[model samples]
Target: MFVSRLLDFQKTRYARFMNHRVPSNCRYQPTEYEHAANCATHAFWILPSILGSSILYILSDDQWETISAWIYGFGLSSLFIVSTIFHTISWKKRHLRTVEHCLHMFDRMVIYFFIAASYAPWLNLRELGPWASHMRWIIWIMASVGTVYVFFFHERSFGGRDAGAGMREQGRAAMTCFFHMVAPNGKQKAPGVSPKPQTPDSELAAPRPG
Candidate 1:
């Protein structure tokens, strides 16, 4: 029974993740779109620890100041590059505000994690003594604040009225054109762009004679 309940809970969580509709206003460029998603959905949580630990191992000295500076610079540069690429493509594509907002949230969260982890070791170093005591609190506070912001900032538009719906409509138009190019008789035109459905008068109420 316990195993069954756990499986049920996992199914429910997966459903929630999958069903969360990306706001319709978002226009997705295939490249940057995938990059942003990979960063947010997978790498954001893992990369910081990996990079930070690697940096620590490579450095000859374990001094907090030097390590922190290197980590900060590396973190900022990496995030800035990603943000720049994502924003540039998004702007050119005229993506919806919701997409832009979501991207920003993703970037901020990654940066937040990087910054927090970079200082975490300092909070634990024995030599730091009294200062180390406050380090934990500071890191916790910063992380807490960032998490709250990300949760509150996550917003997206969906459905027919969203800004990106026009782009989707255009995509539908292009797909129809492509179909026509490959197969002149193809019936794959946009739904409403095609002829209206016809029904027998018996299937509808007949108009009264004038």
Candidate 2:
């Protein structure tokens, strides 16, 4: 009877605590790099399509001589190259994967569509005529719609705290290994496997009075 009442009390206390409100201003915000990374990811979704359109335009219209093919090729390749750099930097420093790996995967599918749209004209080397123009228009419309949803979903799934917390936890684990003479909490390992060396500051240092 006593134990049941104690359990009920604990449950109620927890419920009350959980219901407490957090201040809006206290909410965590993304770091500038993280924000930039998010913006880049969204921008990337549209870029291939945009480049492909330009390439298609140059190829389709014989009179479209203003834009150089070499310039378009160089620019298109550079955008993808820059995106790779962003992914590499984010992975190494933050250990943060982009939020929508699946959506990004989907975006890649759209990229192929754009590439095909661009390449189809040149490949057949015949006029796209009526049918091909309609297909290209359809691809553009679908890509624009998909990009909006994917970007919105990604922003909601990932936040700055996710990146910060991941790095912080790693640092904590390393600190634990360097400090305690024994395993922090877990059972001792076998004789052959040596434990990590403990640092001096973690041992026997007299605590200063508060």
Q: What is the lDDT of residue 123 in candidate 2?
A: 22
Against the true structure, what is each candidate's TM-score?
A: 0.34, 0.31
Q: How close is candidate 1 to the true structure, as a TM-score?
A: 0.34
Query: Model 2, which residues run further than 4 Å from truth?
Result: 1-61, 64-75, 95-117, 120-125, 155-210
lDDT of 2 by residue, 1-210 (tens): 878777663367445323333353342334455556655775565567567646656664333322324433543554465455544454454444454354344433344333433433332332233344344345435445444544454323344333224333433432332233233355443223445777688465867669
- lDDT measured at residue 57 in model 2 versus the true structure, 0 to 100: 60
Best candidate (score: TM-score): 1
Q: Spell out the clash pairs found in candidate 2.
A: none
Question: What's the lDDT for candidate 2?
Answer: 0.43
Candidate 1 ranges beyond 4 A from true positions: 1-56, 60-78, 121-126, 153-210
lDDT of each: 0.48, 0.43
- Model 1 C-alpha lDDT per residue in residues 62-91, reported as the tens digit of each score: 355454556554655566555664455454
In model 2, the Cα lDDT at residue 109 comes to 36
RMSD of 2: 26.6
Error of 2 at 74 (Å): 6.3
